[model samples]
Target: MIVAHWPPISATLCPKFSGHVNKPLKGLRSFTFNSSFSFKASFRCYCIKNENPNKISSEEGFSVLGSDIPWDSGSIWSTMAFYFFSLHIPFSFGGLSVVAQILHQPVIDPQTEALSILTLQTLELIGALLLLNYTAKPGYRFSVFRDVIINLGMSKRPQDRHAVGWSSPTAVNNPILKEILLSSNVSEIACILVYCIVTPLLEETVYRGFLLTSLASTMKWQQAVIITSAIFSAAHFSGENSLQLFIIGCVLGCSYCWTGSLSSSIVIHSLYNALTLTITLLS
Candidate 1:
């Protein structure tokens, strides 16, 4: 016959063993003591620091990819609207006028036309810079241009190579482009400065620095890059070279994302335009 034992009320209230108390029942010993031990062990395990210092915690990883803005902030939408109205619409009108004049003119005055376009671009650039100063966070004034060049080399895949070869413009094939490229003296110098420096700086500031950063506050970085690139390409208003411009926009967007610096994108864009202009002149 089994003997029945009832634990004292004190034993039930405080399961911890004391030298003065009798040993607990065999069933209660394993259930109460082992459970407490297991819980203590688990708590200790969690308290210990991770062995790998390089490994990011789950929370940190999520924070890195997540939006930087508060849910209540409407700055993103306001900035987007400002960019569309202040920059995109005005530039689209100017670009359309240029295209129309180029098509209609029997004999183009490359110098006069280039100077007029440069004047318009300068005004637009000034407006964009002012808007950026007001709406966006302060941007880095300097970046490692060589690092961006290295990244461009490292990131190039077969598809990118194909796109570059396929979309590269030839002055011989496009008469209007050829006329612009073959300009002489002051006109050529002005065109070069506009393409290589002014245009790249303005475009990178507006699209990558302002628009992309604003969008990233509300969406994933990848989505921001895609949307910014699409808008940038569309803003160029180049019918034949639209695909080429889009591909270039994607490249610039990715560079901006990786470097987190508008200067890097500006450098890459300036270099690209200079190289293409060189090729056009040589051919």
Candidate 2:
């Protein structure tokens, strides 16, 4: 207590203590501020670089095969009209000619009927291919068709014979059809090929692939399927069997819509025709 250098303890000591306490807090504040700024900058960069994962790409929206027809284009109607006339007019004329030729014959044999069926089916198949190639770019692929067939096989149900009118004796009693079924020669083989393969392929490609797709461009899918089915049934010109044909057509249309492949409907139709032919042969 000798008053040894009691030189202003309040000023010097208080200033030194306050400086020591303030230094670490200032460094901590600077570090926190720099870290926050850097975090904000990186966050902005990440936001700028990333895309929304939920967005649908254009390719995905329009990648449905057989649906590549330019529905919105003005030329679509003209193209449809061309397809209709080119396909049906030639087929109708050729079919009538064949019927006329057959009727004119002194004898309408099974071989003759088979030949006529083969000719008609061949013409139809050719016309279908032409129309498909002309109207739709990147036309139906075999892979797509195969997928459709597989799907049809997986989804098929056993149909009721009576309900579908197949139980009616008259259904399989057509003289021409009976002759083809009864024959065991090459004519019968040809008949089977036409009914089970060529006919189904042509009809399904036209009605389901081309017509249904065209109709769907303007109408609801349900309406398109119904209208196309109705037209398909009407094209057969079946009398009392028209109702059965209509039901079959509806089934085919639904199959096409479900699978988005003409081949599916074709396979179902072929199997149905094959079953009918088999039953007729047995009976």
Candidate 3:
């Protein structure tokens, strides 16, 4: 009886493997292995990135057209959490409100209102973008849009485009928000910045853009929409405002899911806020 010993397969043997790997399935890398014995055999090995057979597509949230939101569900959650604590600690009312009270400027805060509230919105947006850029994959940073103008322009119809990701998985809206400071000394400019510009951009980006879009990649998109819209509503937090905000959130969420971009929602949000503020001021 002859017991033949075989050397461990090395990388060099891969070249001689006769199996042909066709264009691999999405999220799959194919490897070929060969064995020489009584009969030659070729084996194909596939390393799958999205291994789940039940993973849903983003576009399927409303239709089969597909999702434009990039990043996996895991990345979505991690980034959302990171974005929240990083911004919330510095910018939210609870945060700066404490500093204002301590500084004895609670009643007359001209400088703080201007510096920390009015101007700070721009800084916060810049910081959020920078953070997103840092965490995004190699080629795509804020690659969520078909066109950059779409975030600020008119709505575009949904298409058959899909998102690419390092792995597969799924936001509700952000909880951090901007609001009109009730202090008598708070500037109208600060209110404008918070409502017209800051609130719409920050909230919409967090809620409709990232949160809602991320959830679009799931099987239960309707639930995701309702949940995210509810979160957006809760951030405003008032017995009177809750129902109104919830309705608005539903509209924004549906607009995003249908139009496949943030522009329409942002426009609507900005307009509604501006109108409400204007009416409040006039009255």
Give the whole-model CA lDDT for all candidates, comma-separated. 0.54, 0.56, 0.54
TM-score sort, best first: 2, 3, 1
Clashing pairs in 1: none
Say which prediction, candidate 2 or candidate 3, comes out ahead on lDDT. Answer: 2
Q: In model 3, where do residues sit more than 4 Å from their true spots?
A: 1-65, 98-104, 110-115, 142-150, 153-186
- Per-residue accuracy of model 1 over 1-283 as CA lDDT, tens digit each: 2333344323222233322333444554223222222221111112344499788765335323235522224665676578667765564244435544666853336665556556656666666555544554434212323332323211110000111121223122444444655776777776676677677776776677656766776777777778888887666545666677778888888777766666677778878877766766766
Q: What is the Cα-based TM-score of model 3?
A: 0.58
* Clash list (residue pairs), candidate 3: 59-66, 59-67, 73-170
Give one clash count per candidate, in the order shown: 0, 0, 3
Query: What lDDT does candidate 2 reach at residue 102?
Result: 49
Q: Rank the candidates by lDDT, best first.
A: 2, 1, 3
lDDT of 2 by residue, 186-280 (tens): 78887677767776776676677667777766666677778877876665544677788778878888777767777678787888888877777
Which candidate ranks first by lDDT, i.e. highest?
A: 2
**Could you give candidate 3's per-residue lDDT for residues 198-259 as a string of tens digits?**
66776677776667767867646677789888876655434555677788889888887777
| Model 2 alpha-carbon drift over 4 Å, by segment | 1-104, 137-170
Where is model 1 more than 4 Å wrong at Cα? Answer: 1-78, 95-108, 136-173
- Residue 105 accuracy (lDDT) in model 1: 55
lDDT of 1: 0.54
